[model samples]
Target: MIPAAHAPTPARRLTVEQVLTGRLVQPLFQPIVDLTTGMVVGLEALARGPAGTVLEFPDRLFAAAIDAGCLGALDLLCSERSLECAIAATTPPPLLFTNAEPAVLDQPLSPHLIELVGGGLPFRQVVEFTERALSAVPGSMLRIAGQTQRWGNGLALDDVGVDPMSLAFLPLVEPEVIKLDMSLLRDPDGDHTRSVCAVVRAEADRTGALVVAEGIETPGDLDTARLLGAQWGQGWLFGRPAGIEQRHRYDASAADLLRPARPGFHERSERAYDCAVDAATPSVATRAEVVAALSRLRDVVAAHDTAVVVMSSADTGLPGVALSLAELASSGRPVIVLDQPATTEFVVAAIAPGRGCAVGLRTSNVLELVTVDDLPTVAVMARALLNRHR
Candidate 1:
């Protein structure tokens, strides 16, 4: 429809062959932090071309690779280089997140992608699958996810909500991390965005997965993400992607997820239980019933010198629970998670990741576990077990 002279030209960049032969692809790391404590939880490895080149940015680099029918090769190069760079980085963190195209995952690896990742690398790896890749080869995604998990690595669903197919693929892949697309939060008032977050929150709650908000550029973006149930976040607002020399610094001690409670924490947990508390359950079929049960149970626990607070889980999912638990646990508070007997497996998986002096109990079996004649005995035993672990 247009003249030959007016035809659109593709951007000039390194050819796929050139990039592979020249090794022009470099890995840049970006910190994904726990917003509540400003702790650097993980670093996502991003691919960048040589400075001053058309492919300097990753989008441009991948666009060229897609046009040249060499996207797989580029993805492989990026993965390998990311591992190399991460290993060489000064004081590498515990988790190194990397990206992989679906096609690359489908192909048989010479050295094997897992080998490159697990071969004496000290850090746990998270392989993020792009939206396009998830949409195209869901079967491969599931296979790769299982393979990675088997190796003790993590799997992330990248750019969630960018494609309609992502939702369909989610249950099948069942990734450990979900990176929400930034566009969803670009406009805070968008009903569609809020609805998407609500859905993600529920899914994460049901699956016990972590939520990471991507593309946070401003304070508002971070705030909205926090409100929408994302405990971990990544964006330029924290720090731009950079080489190891420019890696973002964080106060690792600020996060107390792995910290042990002090010796006298039992009295503190009992004190916290006595204060005002809130409760929430998003998955429960009847909200009123759960609230009433928690209310009565709170009274019983309080009688034994243990304060109880029941935070609502209606809006935020497990992340909401985790964030709440982190705050409570950091202050030496003990949390008791009560769930229906049938849902014990799901409840355990979801709440196990939270940082707190906590115990999970099935509602119907509570009496069986402890003598029903002495309800106060339950609280005493809980506090004793928590203290023993501490």
Candidate 2:
């Protein structure tokens, strides 16, 4: 049997409150070096709780915040501190990389930050979002990506290999930099690693997006990063993440190396196509046919761990759809069912980046299937529908 997850201890909850209220979390900067030139190209701000505390480790600190239902608050605190700490460093940063938890990407910034936006930030900021969130919450990811660009910062897809589904989303995210997970560095020659490297290289080749590899402690690991076509790398081999008190020297060429990819960040999305569904298209199959086809689509998409399904709660009575949704949700895909209208009814639809949506409705299908004209937009619309319903 699956065990229940643990909740944060009262002590941990108190630690979180103190950490936020007192601004006790320390920000550490790790140098991202250019592999070829061995220059400090960027500094990624790493956060830590007060030294020697139970919540000193970031993983533990975030887990506690999540359990305490304060992850959004903590995420904002980290992002704001990361930027401010980097700006106040002894040396000016060429590029400042700040991470935002997907949950908090949509939340409003602090008033101080809002005012800072008007005055303009002092450094080039790159916002990193995890690849898992790209697949888990495509709609939220897209909206935040747009807002991030509007704020004049770069967007990065972090831990790219952790979620294979994210490879399909590269076109949609169009990140300025692709940060590879350390697992790829440990076994760069493995089949999974090779496949991920190929996909990342393809995106980089086509779009000129910069690639930075993590967990590089050895010169041999540096070679592996180059083999993966990574232009920049970060890990202990260069230097472990350090506090502002530590004096770190950076090369003037750091921004020059990454500037070419900046345009891709500010450009419009690459995939362009219409996703509107017309009910009278006359191609939609009968209810049974749609159920069988969507079942097949579910089996395929579930393997990729992609697709977010949304439906009206009142429509689950359809013969095969409810069972299919159960399987989809079990596979760890999102399946949001909104409250049903008094007289409204629809069938099932599954929208994902990989395969075009499948299934059509008799009257008003929950999410109608469509061709690959533009699957990402359909997924966003699906999420927007759920948000509106909420």
Candidate 3:
């Protein structure tokens, strides 16, 4: 029998008192370097909780904050801590990249922003609005965008290609900076994500805005971002997040540390995609009804390729949104997400093709374009296209 994957240890939850006390949330900085000059142009502040705590990690930290109904409070604290840290730095970079959620934006400008306006800030400030939330409320975002701009702070649309709604609001927000989502670089052979990156570059050029590529974890990703017209990048390859005291201590030549891509990475990636298509036995059903069939469908796919599984839209976020993205990244098997017409296109657009992902095409709201009348035919076509590309 195949060994089961180890389950993660449960995180120790953080109480609202700890959050309000400002004793648990610690702000760490990650450098954003200029691709052409290899100089650190800015630092993005990331939040972490005290060591050995459940909230020590960022995803868990924010998740707990959300659960406790203190998301806005946490955001404000992060902003305050980030600026305080930057001010404490002996020679902080000229740009400080911080974040403000939609909830925080709907209210008056963050007090940290007001503090910057009081003449102590020695550099330009950037306030990033992650598009995942902004996409749902365009009107509130527009108002906040205007409010930030009026405060003399640069605006950034974070995770540009990850959410389809970001695309629709791009022209409307006209942000001074657009951050290309790192998911775009995950699949070496995925043409769609690359095409979207190119489109983002073209749009940035047209608007006279700079494009910052987030998550440049590998040398290949760095090179790809440069070729795709990214002027700036942030990720572990440059430096891991650190306190202000150690922020400037990273290796200036960290880009040189990018190991050569393994000889068969591309071939293996393509083969994985081909296997997913060949393994799937498609079914016809509505989004709501698909949940009941997921177990059987997962078994069918696993019988052919044990790594793959089928998931319904409802299954998504039953845990957390980040968990879905993590599944997309880790599962060697293709995760075919079944959803209604409105979400199918967005999910498909967000996924990298070579990472074992394919959206079951929907016609109207009921039937799949590829799996309606036959399943084998769709598999055959998918295999043919994938093999041809290979």
Candidate 4:
């Protein structure tokens, strides 16, 4: 006979049976912003227990669920809640990042869950994989790597730069985004951390993947992230987790969030001028013009050290440049050609074609100027110049 005061409290274990019965798990959103633009690019879905429950912490809840062999059910529930909440909410379209375990990737995603998410949400929805946790599962990591690409879902490698395992996975998986751990940015000078970050940046550039530096606590950390070429940044420096209503009310524009604390007179003037310019000239250049200019410039630069090609526009901006044969023969420095009139203080150096075409010896270093319709001309000139120089 046990006394009433000494009655035993049963162990509160969340089992698979209980989870399968549709125990609701609410998802909270934390914003991920572009540091340069200051716009909320996406929201990371965080799991939470139902209202008025003792189990509140997502970490604890998830761990318990895993131990009870209810991970699949828990994962499905979280996904369903996140998709439902996102579609039902009034917030603007943003990329939704959901945490996924490696094991879950091999299993077929629930049709109900897919239907909810696929109804309106775009495939830009990112599935963030925990590097350390994924490594532990057998054949799960490879399965996830294959499925993410096949499903056309964006893959994100989270907690990178801290685990050596991430180094191998990064090149193999080639995720859409790589999230650098906050610890690496905390003390950038710490043993090989800077080097590791450099390697990560290079890999990201090569793969055309965006870099997100996480755990930015101070302005210094933000600066470090920017220096390391992180396009997007997340941390306490931005905003913490808040309700959708609260976040919606808060302004997330670049001008609002990135306003200088104490701007100088010149800075203020520049901002005003920039705003006016942006408003006045919205469609500056067409994509075609931009691509043509870049292609011509790349070819010209490859040929000589001081080549020049002018655009056929009214303004006649410096559209292309390269090194001249004489300049290359003398010095290795590449020279840029300017189109605008020389100021009183500065003189524009001229490039004159050599006389008597001695074949390879004097194949006219000056390449053909590229026009809007002259992409082939630029390529031909580039090849000729390279052959002569070589």
Q: Higher-TM-score candidate among 1 and 2?
A: 2
Q: What is the TM-score of each candidate against the true structure?
A: 0.59, 0.71, 0.58, 0.57
Superposition-based RMSD of candidate 3 using all C-alpha atoms, in angstroms: 16.5
Q: What TM-score quantifies how close candidate 3 is to the native fold?
A: 0.58
2 or 3, greater by TM-score = 2
Model number with the top TM-score: 2
Report the lDDT tens digits of candidate 4 across residue range 66-160: 78787887888888877777777776435677888665655677888767655545424677888654445423444444444444456688988
| Model 3 pairs in collision | 12-54, 334-356
Instruction: Encode model 3's per-residue lDDT on 163-202: one tens digit a residue.
Output: 5445534544456778988887676347757656766765
Using lDDT as the measure, the top candidate is 2
Better of 2 and 4 by TM-score: 2
Q: Model 2, residue 193: what's the lDDT?
A: 92
Instruction: Name the runs in model 4 displaced over 4 angstroms.
Output: 1-20, 118-123, 248-390
| Model 2 poorest 10 in a row by lDDT | 266-275
For model 2, residues 289-331, the per-residue Cα lDDT tens digits are 6566656756755765545455433444555544555564556
Which rank order by TM-score, best down to worst? 2, 1, 3, 4
